[model samples]
Target: MSDGADTGEAGEPGTEARPGLVRRFLLGLIVVLPMSAALIAGGAFLYGKWRFNAPGPAAAPTVVWLAPGHGLSSIAERLREAHVLDETGIFRLAVELNRAAGALKAGEYEIPAHASMADIVRILREGKSIVHRITVPEGLTSQEAMEIVRADPVLTGDMPPVPAEGSLLPETYNFSRGTTRAQIVQRMQKSASALINEAWPHRTANLPYKTQREAIILASIVEKETGLAAERPKVAAVFVNRLRKPMRLQSDPTIIYGITGGKGPLGRPIRQSELDRVTPYNTYQVDGLPPTPICNPGRASIEAVLNPPETNDLYFVADGTGGHAFASSLADHGRNVARWRQVEKKAVQVPVKAAEERTAGTKPVIPLKAPARHVGG
Candidate 1:
């Protein structure tokens, strides 16, 4: 029994004592070493990513003023140098990624320094830049347009040599502040070209004018001749018919344009002597269309020339109601003219003035008789 007990305690078959010291040490090492290595590698990876991905401190706000004609590379460099972008290469990459490389608009922009690449890309892509609006009214000469551009605070630089009269189309144009006057003038020229090209395709056939420029010149005359919108086509037709018959246009506005040189507004009414003035632009003296456009014709004026009113009437005179009376025969014109003159005389005889004067005057003043043929035609 003692022997069996000794064998069991020394070399037991079914029971085992605690593991050897070295074996225990190796098992503990096997579990701890890999866990320690994995923890160290994870910490290192996280630190590396944080160090690379984190951006630097916030930068100050910076103003980026983009003058006219500045290219994209110059603007990008400016942003990079201002520290608005950490690297221009990164910015370019971002622009390419967003497909905004070709979408950056030319204008002034304000970017905060140390702005993220994403922010800069958004600003350029969205074109949140400075904007200026210039309104050019109808019937203004190129010189008048230049004066407007020169006077505007948003536009910069001097006007180029004055464009041909009526070459610049009158419309509202949008540009960036600080854009050059020459650039704006060029834009006007382009607009005029485009408008004429587009309108020429739609013009009526068998017209008097051979080319679009002549049509524009005639339309300008018609625009300046009347303030009534409904009369534009009629006035255009009058000129067109006269041109077809090779008769003198005899338009009074042409005479005024010759006298004023298209610099300032003609503040007063036209006179007879001015109408008789001999100038290349004076339709009263010249038989055909004017040498050039007298004023900037608007789209309505252009369309009026393109499609003139169908009428056999050649003579038109103010009917004292903001519209003109059309007459086909001299006799009919005479009657209309007489009626218009009577209306004018009656309008001039103000009721208040006549009543007040009648009480003051002791001797009755004989009213002068208007001439039988003295009427507008």
Candidate 2:
């Protein structure tokens, strides 16, 4: 009995120790591999964060333009090409994690100095882009205004179709980087229509304008006659009085529009030869308002023709100042024309610098708008 008990005790020690050895190996494995994996994962995650958040290579405020229809991958490549990023993989992952890959907008963005990838992505997602303003002044022909729009550096895309003359309203318009020229022209047309619709009903009675189109035509002339805002009503009165008698409008702007088709300025003073030249738009030869408006008249100019001040004046000439001198009688008009010639003579004597100051705004110049018929009228 004693020998059998000793042998069982020895076997028990060996069996218990084998189980302990297996338990120790399992515990070590569970602790070691997971901990090692965690350390590696943590290192990768920290590296990604640091790279994505680091400042870009731009030393100054830079403009970044993303064209329309570009995907996130293309944009990322562009950024890397612009030297704005060191690596693109992290940026891609960050954008995906934020679910912003499809939300990028096309526009010109003014990125700050040292902008991080996250900063750029946030800006692109939010569409915080650049805004540019273009102001179209009153009385510009559609062609002239379009020239300005075409030359603008802010707008993009192909040049839009030129609308009918006097279709666009004169005002300041705002646009983003990728805004098309056609879009701006369409906007102007809408604005002009609104102004016309608003002011058409308020025009004076017996205006001799058979249609709203005729009034707009007359308003365009009034706009071209003078640059003075205060003079618009008086200018409108001259045309209105003549129209009351149904006399020839005989405006010089009509003569110029006939010559150039509103595509460019006459670039010189009107001559007697050009005045006698018969054209559809020439008011001297035509009986009524021209076929269409000569230029895009502003709201005030349109308003002036719609509600002109009371006056008996039928003729006007420049009063040596920017404004015009008015007269009711043909004799008085002739006298005014004579004085205007004298003023013109004296103006020719002006120093080049002084003349430069007189028309410094570079608005179209009107020279010798009056001829023999205007003096007689």
Candidate 3:
């Protein structure tokens, strides 16, 4: 009986050792699994932080014009393609976490050199975009202005046909990127109409113009004649005084318009033949204002015509300077014209003499003294 008991005990002893080994294995797993999971999660968090805060890959400061319907995911993909971001998928995920995917605004955005992905996201969400400006100078024909609009690469839309002359108000227009050209033209027209409405009511009393159209037609002539802002009121007065006498307008710009139909620059000085040509727009031969405005007049020119300076000056001739000298009498005008011719003679000789001196390696001649007086001399 003792020997049988010993054999059974020996077999059961191995079974007991196996159970002990199994318990140790399970305990080790229980302790190591949580630690491994913690290490992995911590590593992932650190990697995300590094990526989110790191500078982007753009070589220089860049501008991205985000158009309408550009989603955050799409933008991220584009950034990845441009090497601006290393991980587009991670960027998209970050955007979702921030809850900003749906709030981004479309505009021209300046991305700083080496900006973080997070910086870009915040910039888009905050709607910080670059504003662009286009300044249409005063006195450009509508055709010329439309050419300016068509040439701007930033503006998008179907180009409108050339508008009528004197229609658009020339001014600096501000817009965000992706603005249409047609909208700008509409704004200009509306501004011009509004200005005319405001100024027409306060025009000088006893003016020959029965309608605002006449004033605009006359103002455009004055605009093309002189660039001097201060001289506009006097120029308007000279034309107005002539109109009262019922004399011909006789504006040189009108004759030029009659020849070219206001399409472009005549590219040369007016000839006697062109001045005598009897077109509907020819003020040299016509009895009153031209059929329409010669060019797009500015607000100042329009206002000047509507409110001319108090003067009875009948004629004005170019003085020795760029400005003109006014005369109320024909004899005074003849003297001014003679002085202007002398100034013209000197002007013609100056460039020729300068070139000759340069060719001969001689010192330049002193500037000729301006006439002591233009109108009275």
Sorted by lDDT, highest first, which candidate order results? 2, 3, 1
Q: Candidate 3's residue-wise lDDT over 1-377, tens digit each? A: 99999887787446768878999999999999999999998898778878988888887878886778988877887667666687787788878888888988888888888889888888888997998888889888888889899998888898987888898888999999888999888988898899999999998899989888888898898898777898899888988988999877778777777777767877777777876788877677778898888888999999999999889787887786668899888888898788788887887798789889989999887555433222122
Each candidate's TM vs. the true structure?
A: 0.65, 0.79, 0.81
Output the worst ten-in-a-row residue range by lDDT, candidate 3. Answer: 368-377
Better of 1 and 2 by TM-score: 2
Off by over 4 Å in 2: 1-15, 28-47, 133-137, 149-161, 202-206, 276-279, 329-335, 348-377
| Angstrom error at residue 8, model 3 | 10
Clashes of each: 0, 0, 0
Clashes of 3: 0
Which residue pairs in candidate 1 collide? none
State the C-alpha lDDT per candidate.
0.75, 0.84, 0.83
Ranked candidates, highest TM-score first:
3, 2, 1
Q: Is candidate 1 or candidate 3 better by lDDT?
A: 3
lDDT of 2: 0.84
Question: 220-329 in candidate 1: lDDT tens per residue?
Answer: 88777676777889888877777887778877667767888888767677777876668797676778988988998888888999989788767777776667787767
Q: Which ranges of candidate 1 are over 4 A from the true structure? A: 1-106, 109-121, 350-376
